[model samples]
Target: MSESFQLRVNDVEYPLSVDQGRNLLGVIRTEIGLTGTKEGCDDCECGACMVLIDGQPVNSCSYLAVQAQGREITTVEGLAEGDELDRLQRNLLEVGGVQCGFCTPGMLMSATALLAEHDDPSDDEIRIGLSGNLCRCTGYARIIEAVRRTADGA
Candidate 1:
């Protein structure tokens, strides 16, 4: 039987009825209409479905909807304030970090989590923090540069 749960997504609370084994990615995309969280490998490898769960980055493709109850879930849609973009988002654009844009959301979520903890993370630390999120385009150099730029306030 399906169960009902509340999810705080992108700073909005949504009461949804989901299947017993529904994953957060599917729920977010299909139910809540948030398409930023892409489903890549669905095995927790690609990190394409990354989202912030209580300020921590997680693979939403493998995370159950029930597990997200009462937690603050942040998606790519939440990174900006109206017309203003987040620092990382702006840096990504300026540094050419986005191509194809499938992995951009996940990359942003992971980088956001890292910045939340370490505003001045080193390049190596940024690399390690974003190791799980993969990008087929841009070669990840630009993405890394974007994160570093955000950290450095550039």
Candidate 2:
């Protein structure tokens, strides 16, 4: 059965009635119209649907909309402030981290979480932070460098 639900996403609260177990990925993309969060390997194994819940990276594909409750959620759309992109986003483009573009959002979310915790993340640390996100394109080298450069204050 469907019921009324509410979730705070990107600093905004959305209230709607949806299927009990609808994934956050679908809610964010379909209900809220923020399509940057991609859906790949919907089983939560690919990390393409990664998003931030209270500053932690999570797979939205597996996270139910109802589970979000009153927690803060951050999606790729929240990474920017008006016209300015976040440092991680600028670095991603400058370092050529985005290729196919499908994995960029999830990768950025993961990197954002890592940078939030460690300002000077090592190469291995960056890898570990982004380990959950899989990208078939760009080989991850540029992506790693992008995160590294941002973390190094470059």
Candidate 3:
């Protein structure tokens, strides 16, 4: 039997009837049509499916959809304001943090969560905060730079 639940994504509340055991990444992408949350490794190691659940980062690919009930979920698609990108998003572009773009969304989400907690995160804090997210491209230097720039208001 399928269970119905309400999920708030990007500030929009959506009613989803999902399988009892469906993972969050599939439900977000297939049911809600939010493809920005990528699924990589599906084992919570790659962080490709990172999303903010109540302002905390989680691997959506491994997170059960039902577990998100009553929680605010933020995806990459939620980080923008109409046509304008979020500060982190703009910084990523300026710093060349995006390569294949698969991990970019996760990295952005993680960075957003980190910045929310620490507006002026040190380099070590930034590195440790983003350690879970793995980017095959860009070698993480540009990604780190982007987060640092955003935190520094650059």
Candidate 4:
């Protein structure tokens, strides 16, 4: 049987009925109609399904949708203010951190959480912050640079 619950995502509340076993990623993409979060390994190996839960990064693929009902979830879509991209988003593009773009959302989410906690992070700190995410297209140098630039207010 499915359970009906509310998920506050991207500052919007969405009431949904889904199977109790449904993952947050599926619910966010299918039920809530937000596709910014991607499903990579689906086993929590890749951070492609990463989203912010109460300002912390989480792998939505392994996290149940029902468990996310009471928390604030921030997806990649939430990072932007309408047509204008967030600073990190613009930096990612400006630094050529995005390649195929499959991993960009998760990367952005993780980096967002990192920057929220650490105003200025070192190279090691940035690496540790984005350790969960795996990117195949960009060697992660540009991605790291983008995060560093964001931290440096550049």
Candidate 5:
């Protein structure tokens, strides 16, 4: 049964009707029209569908939409403030962390949560934080550097 629910996404409150087991990924991308979050391994093996649920990274592909009611969610679209890009984004570009870009958004979101918890994450922390996200394009060195740069530069 679909019921009324309010989901605060990217700082905007959206009224929606979602049933249990309705994937948050579809709601965010199709219903809400925020496609920055990619769908990879639907089984949660790939971190491409990552989003921040109340400031913590979660794989939206398997997360139920109804579970997000009354909670804050942040997609890749929320990383920027108008024209100013988040430091992680800037560093990603500057450090060549993005290549094919399929995994960029997830990487950025995961790194955002990591940096939020640890402003200066060590190399191992960056690796562990990004372990869920897989990037076949740029490898991981650049991505790790980008996160490190963003955290250190902050």
Candidate 6:
């Protein structure tokens, strides 16, 4: 059954009528028309579907859309300003952390949450922060470097 629901995404409000069991990824991509969040493994084994809920990283593929009603939602698309990229996005590109880009969104989201929680995360902390996101192209050294660089304000 479809019910009235509202989601605050990227600081904007979207009112939707969706099934209660619908996943937030679908709702974010389809219903709200934001597609930066990818659906890699529908089973939640992959972090490609990660998003931020109340500043915490979440596997949106397995999270019910209805459960996000009152919380703040942030997607990869929300990471940038009008025509500028987020510092992390710029760092990833500069450090060559993004290749095929499938896992970049989730990585950015997870790293964002991590950085929010830790101003100066260690190498181990960065690895643990990005443990959920998987990148097939880069071996993660550059990604870790990018996060480290961002943390260091370099």
Against the unseen true structure, what C-alpha lDDT does each candidate score?
0.92, 0.93, 0.93, 0.96, 0.92, 0.94
RMSD of each: 0.8, 0.8, 0.8, 0.5, 1.0, 0.6
Clashes of each: 0, 0, 0, 0, 0, 0
In terms of TM-score, how similar is model 4 to the real structure?
0.99
In candidate 3, stretches whose alpha carbon ends up further than 4 angstroms from where it belongs are none
Off by over 4 Å in 1: none
Off by over 4 Å in 6: none
TM-score of 5: 0.96
Where model 5 places Cα greater than 4 Å from the true spot, the runs are none
Tell me how far the alpha carbon of residue 129 in candidate 1 is from the true structure, in angstroms, after superposition.
Answer: 0.5
Please report the candidate that would top lDDT against the real structure: 4
The lDDT ranking, best first, is 4, 6, 2, 3, 1, 5
Instruction: Write model 6 residue lDDT over 1-154, tens digit each, in one string.
Output: 9989799999999999999989999999999999999999988887999999999999999999999999999999999998899899999999999999999999999999999999999899999999988888999999999999999996
Model 2 TM-score? 0.97
- Between candidates 2 and 4, the one scoring higher on TM-score is 4
Error of 5 at 86 (Å): 0.9
Q: 3 or 6: which has the higher TM-score?
A: 6
lDDT of 2 by residue, 37-147 (tens): 999999989899999999999999998898888899999999999999989999999988898899999999999999999999899999999999999999999999999
Please give the lDDT score at residue 56 for candidate 3. Answer: 99
Once model 2 is optimally superposed onto the true structure by TM-score, how far is the C-alpha of residue 90 displaced, in angstroms?
0.6
TM-score of 1: 0.97
